[model samples]
Target: MNKKLCLGAFMRPISLHTAWWRHPNAAPQANFDFPIIKDLVRKLEDACFDAVFLADHLAVMNMPTNALKRSGTITSFEPLTLLSALAACTTNIGLIATGTTSYEEPYLTARRFASLDHLSSGRAGWNIVTTVNTEAAYNFGLESARLHAERYERAGEFFKVVTGLWDGWADDALLMDKESGIFFDPEKIKPLNHKGKYFSVKGPLNIARPVQGWPVIALAGASDAARQMAAESADLVFGNARTIETARSFYKDVKTRAIAAGRNPDHLKILPANQVYVAATREEAYRKKQVMDDLVHVDSNLPNLSLKLGVDVSGFDLDKPLPDIPETEQSKGHQREWIALAQREGLTVRELAKRAAGSGIGEMIGTPSEVADQMEEWLLTEACDGFMMVFHSAPDGYDDFTSMVVPELQRRGLFRTRYEGGTLRDTIGLPRPDSRVD
Candidate 1:
């Protein structure tokens, strides 16, 4: 049997390029416009994408004023609320929303995902993210950001508590018996009574067991702690490797770790994030990318560089090569990527900022056939299971991929022409988790 690719769209802000809104064909307000988002999602479903991954931020003023003013993501609907609305609009495609473990309560996170799973008829997934933006700490009533290790530690425990709550009720727990005045089987439910270093929760989740037993568990990060947790629990692992070699290595490492943790490695699907810019011709694709790159303003570029490096680079001399910088408590993986890129290319501060503003790991830039070729190579070579595609600009960029590239992939027999099943786990070939209560 041949391997099939599992494609997911990284949506919410709707585009990944910093200057996406400035594109001539871009929908500037699409991020906040429900009608636009609905249409885009519907198209993705039509193309048989696996999921729409919605990223979130708890703070609006996380960046400098100049950068904030130019950001399309600063004003957008919350992930769960938007996905819930989307659930009503579409069917089949997974609705994945980011829920922070550092600040959100376990019970609430479990309940929200369970509700979404029920609402979407089991086509829901939770993207577990530890809050990395320091400004988010303030919003959550913390004076300072938690240390990197501490945040991941809390995330591990948080996952256990949430999954435990979700498993509180057996699959047949609710009888809804019309006779005998018995609504449910009292013996079927289990109380979590979870006590952990970071959280304490009493089960069960008020809702019935999710339609897919538990919603698909998805996690993203490159840190060691992150890898460990994903190996132990995540059904879908979003990777960030930039090269085929790097991606293949990451795929092997995570799967190896999963086996070490006594898991079936095939249960963990790894999809590296790729920002794609496709066109009718390869030259046109590169030209479009260059056009988009030119639109990135200095205001947004520098601040993004600072954020990625986990240091304020605003004071650095733009013409000078990046200086030696100590690591901060932000995302170690991200910082390493940026530092490595700069060193490899010997880029100056200004050059690095420009690159960072338009950067994404393994950017696919070419005609539909070219893009399809790259994806096929990655899949066959064990570089990744598939891709979490981040489009360069909204509406047009999305339309191009679906109308152009998706068919190419299907024609090659590397992707599905139709969805395999209704739930996300089925679409991705992951098994539905059995209720722990059993």
Candidate 2:
């Protein structure tokens, strides 16, 4: 085990808070503004963070039409374009951007990440998402979303092809030997004629092998399919967890599964999502949260939650009991996570509704000392290897976190004092994977 904590942000522009744009201090137009991302990356690098990760999907989040009309986080710049700009500004922190195997062709995805890996000198990682939104299928010209089971099946095949493509050329294949006059070595080059249910690709990828062999693969933890993917393939699994017990369970589950799948358990690092609302005092933090909550528009959020949760929550009284929630024994992990939070706190439907709209995860509101206490418990107890930070506002939220929370973590010996290495792989302690041809 590397025995290190990897801290990264679950970065979204402006804030997911609906009224964040209207906040006097919020940068409403920052999502499209280049300097916004540039400055954010510099702050993370300066804070000695490991990476800044952006989650993505191929199409709009399938909010019910009314919800779509009312949302602020409805649209933004493409993550790849944004990450590329981030790469130009920072020298050390990793840049991870989500791309799905469900919709994208493996060779193209491979080539794009390989290019990013090269451009960043191996500081790029792909957050592999088997996109969950069915609306994405229609937008991409498909008739409908692939079946839930089918997406994961295709994803397994997709990883094989991507890794196989990366192995197509041995490092020695580029024999720039002057005297031999043979600028290339045919024997060292390979072609992956991968045939699978979802893809059939032949030959080497257009680009050379990435500096990291395969750029680091990070997975979003949710389904059984996602767990299997992490066990067999991913180097990092971002668990959407709300508590220590759940994160610890997930950490053990993935590590055990990886070993059973013939991989080193340490290869899978468990990271849980955490939201922060920090202030000078605990009361001030609560005040900040209440202010942020006042800004959220319930009407704008209801339909969006309805579609994703597969619960038509529109007609129910906000204060009433949940009804007509679909019956599925299968684990809708995030849905369950929300329920767990409500049940544990004995919260009402209305109260859960309010917190749910503020940010993607449950909130950790307090002074830096209080926040640091929770974080220390999570890491030291082995509940998570690290955290995926969700900020309340763009630059201001991030600036507050770095200035206030980060120093506390550093003092606790939970995060870095200075960046340890140049490339993302180095920070993660992953030696460059040797080309399979070699």
**Per-model TM-score on C-alpha atoms:** 0.97, 0.94
Top lDDT model: 1
* Residue 328, model 2, lDDT: 40
lDDT of 2 by residue, 4-94 (tens): 5778877764455666665668777776677876887788889988888887757766666665665666778788778877777788889
Task: Determine which window of 10 residues in candidate 1 has minimal summed lDDT.
Answer: 354-363
Off by over 4 Å in 2: 1-3, 64-66, 178-180, 327-331
Model 1 lDDT tens row, 1-438: 389888999997788788899999888999999999999999999999999999998888478888888888878899999999999999889999999998999999999999999999999899999898778899888998888898989998998898888888899998888887789997889999988787878777799989998898899988888899899999999987777888998899999999999999988989999988899888999998899899988898889898888899999999999999897888777787788888888999999998888855669889998999999999999888899988888888888899999999999899898876778889989887788776
TM-score between candidate 1 and the true structure: 0.97
How well does candidate 2 score on lDDT at residue 4? 54
Candidate 2 deviates by what RMSD?
2.2
